[model samples]
Target: MTTIAPSRPLTAAGYPRGFKWGVSTSSYQIEGGHDADGRLPSIWDTRCRMQGKIANGDTGDVACDHYHRYPEDIALMKGLGLDVYRFSVAWPRVLPKGKGRVNQKGLDFYDRLIDGVLEAGIEPWLCLYHWDLPQALDDLGGWPARDSAGWFADYAALCCQRYGDRVKHWATFNEFAVFTLFGYCIDWSAPGITDREAHLKAIHHVNLAHGMGVDVIRDLVPGAVVGAVHNRQVVWPEKDTDADRRAAALLDAHWNKAFPDPQLLGHYPDLIAESIAPYVKAGDMAQICRRTDWFGLNHYGPIFAKDDPNATWGFHWGAAPDDADKSDIGWPIWPAAFRDELIGLTKTYKLPIYVTENGMGGNDKVDDKGEVNDATRIRYLTLYTDAMKEAIAAGADVRGYYVWSLLDNFEWGTGYQNRFGLVHVDYETQKRTAKASYAWYRDYIKAARAAE
Candidate 1:
């Protein structure tokens, strides 16, 4: 593990005043009471049952058991000195059948969770969707269906009426491309299907859903901060040739700009607009473009693109250098690109930004002393966060930064193999052990507050 000392103190003086610092988690990733309290099956639940769908056959059926241990988790956040905690609400939990009938018990769970978050002096940043679509909705054709916009709008309106009074900050969706493209185009995620047309249609519907969600929240919750979290990659071409550059631009249009351009700018990038034109309705763009208060960006590292005429998307991922520093999941660590992405998004969107997710996953283990010494994760956080500070100094209006996770939880297709949390979790016993990175973050937050 490479440890680099901070050139200056890790204090609020290094960042803008009133900057928010926090951690993030999703419902299906951390909240494991899968069958508890009248919750119905989500698409992920169905996908987990399929043979060979998840790594090592591991499922989120009992992941971290956060549903039962949120009090302990909130205490952990309070101890970490977090100003906010960003989390997602499972739609299937509240609306078991996806459309009608409210589950009071499910609503009660989040009611208590938000109350607990406030009781602990941490603001709850709630996200409506985090890829755990209701299986009932999937049965009715899911995002590929044009009616998904109405389904999601109804869900959003219900949530706003139920919990929006207490929760002021809300995000409509998380990583539009990951769920739509990976789920529909590549068959890597839930409701796995391999159809380019479905992928394109899913893109339009999800964007429309986001816009409708914004409208619903505005109408239902007064003074609510509404936005969506997008995972934007700083794409680079494998070679500096015209063809490779064009391929990188095309990949950017599909992967990065497809969702945000429509939401923020009210139109798709010209490269893929015609490809997606067939599914778009007359007033879809009007609904897809809403007044988002902030842009939630989830970035990890840069993606290298290469020209591939034979590829389905006219581009293919190029391999990183063998010697490049990487996380346990083999994602290359490029802090410079992280800084670039922050600045680029700020320049393009011109909205106050929140880095909603950024962290490196590692194969962390508790040593014989019953302590986890994840120096690699600590280093990654320090470098990337410092990069974010640099981006802010370079004129990016970044308002907040949240680590990718709060606990070691089920990592989607990778299952529980990747640990990205400052707090380590023992899967068998459900023990929460704070790693060395946890202490580092605590002290950093303390210093930042003191400096402020």
Candidate 2:
């Protein structure tokens, strides 16, 4: 056991009064029932069906089975005393065909979900898209086509009409940067396509969709808490050399700043234009620069870069983080990098920020005592929370912190291999076990609530 040491108690006073504390999860990642209740095929549904992509040949076909077990999941959140619950609405469920006629069964699932969340005394922060675009939509060109923006807006309107009354916190999209880069650029995620032109086009359409979703929510729920959830990376150079600096700048522009620059700054970074102009079109920039209420930042590890003479556009490979530890996913657990990323955003955008997604993944296992006390995960949370406090002290207007997930479930391409949850899931039995980190977070919540 990693012993807990005596230290100054972390307090909410480190953040603004009424700062939100919550946990986040996505539908496809947790809500299994992939084929139940008229939930049609999403890109994830189709992708997981493709062999050799996901580990263990895992499909979300029965992921934590949250679809049939959400009441218990709500109880988990309630027990943790979380103030907010961030989750995504599976697009295919809302619009089975991705456009046109609505799927009442799909909408009804969210209706019950929102109601259940409200009854548990936790606010629902809904992400209109979590990259599980309906396979039907992908058949029609997916996010790369202009029509996707309109299709997403229509889906947004349907959701707003149904559950906008109780669910005030609305996130238009979650991590467009990851979707575009991983899905298209890297071809590692669902609906995978490896064309730079397709990637840039998809990125712009998602931005436009976010703006459109914001409009729909604002119109439906005038006092709605609407925002866009972007995964912001911290890009640092391996050295102070001019080449390294330029490489880091390119990485930052594309990975760290691309999504928010247009929405908040009213223009893509000049560097973004230069890097991606071959794929972008006239007037596309203007449409992507639409406004939003607040910015949701999902930060994890930092990247180190150095110039390469042989890479495309003078861009080069980024260094792996040097944090003492890495997650089961091989992602570095450098909490300070997260803090720095937030501070950088605050300085650049001057907007109210929410740490929308943060967590550590581990292959949690039960010990001889029939308990899964994950010391490493607890340490990750403590260090990360301390870093968040540091960011607040540095004058970042971070108003909330939502851990990446509440329970272990499907992890896209990695499937159920990497667990980034406070609660552990017994995939076979569909059982939920609160790991040591869960109790630690519960205690942290108690501390935060008492701090006020």
- Which regions of candidate 2 deviate over 4 angstroms? 1-13, 237-247, 275-286, 305-324
lDDT of 1 by residue, 200-253 (tens): 989999999999999999999999999999999978888889998998998889
Show the colliding residue pairs in model 2. 304-319
Count of backbone collisions within predicted model 2: 1
Q: What would the TM-score be for candidate 2 when compared with the true structure?
A: 0.92
Query: What is the RMSD, in Å, between candidate 1 and the native fold over all Cα?
Result: 3.8
The whole-model C-alpha lDDT of candidate 2 against the native structure comes to 0.81
Expressed as tens digits, the lDDT of each residue in 71-137 for candidate 2 is 9999999999999999999988778788887888878888888899999999899888888999988
Please give the CA lDDT of all the candidate structures.
0.90, 0.81
Clash count list over all predictions: 0, 1
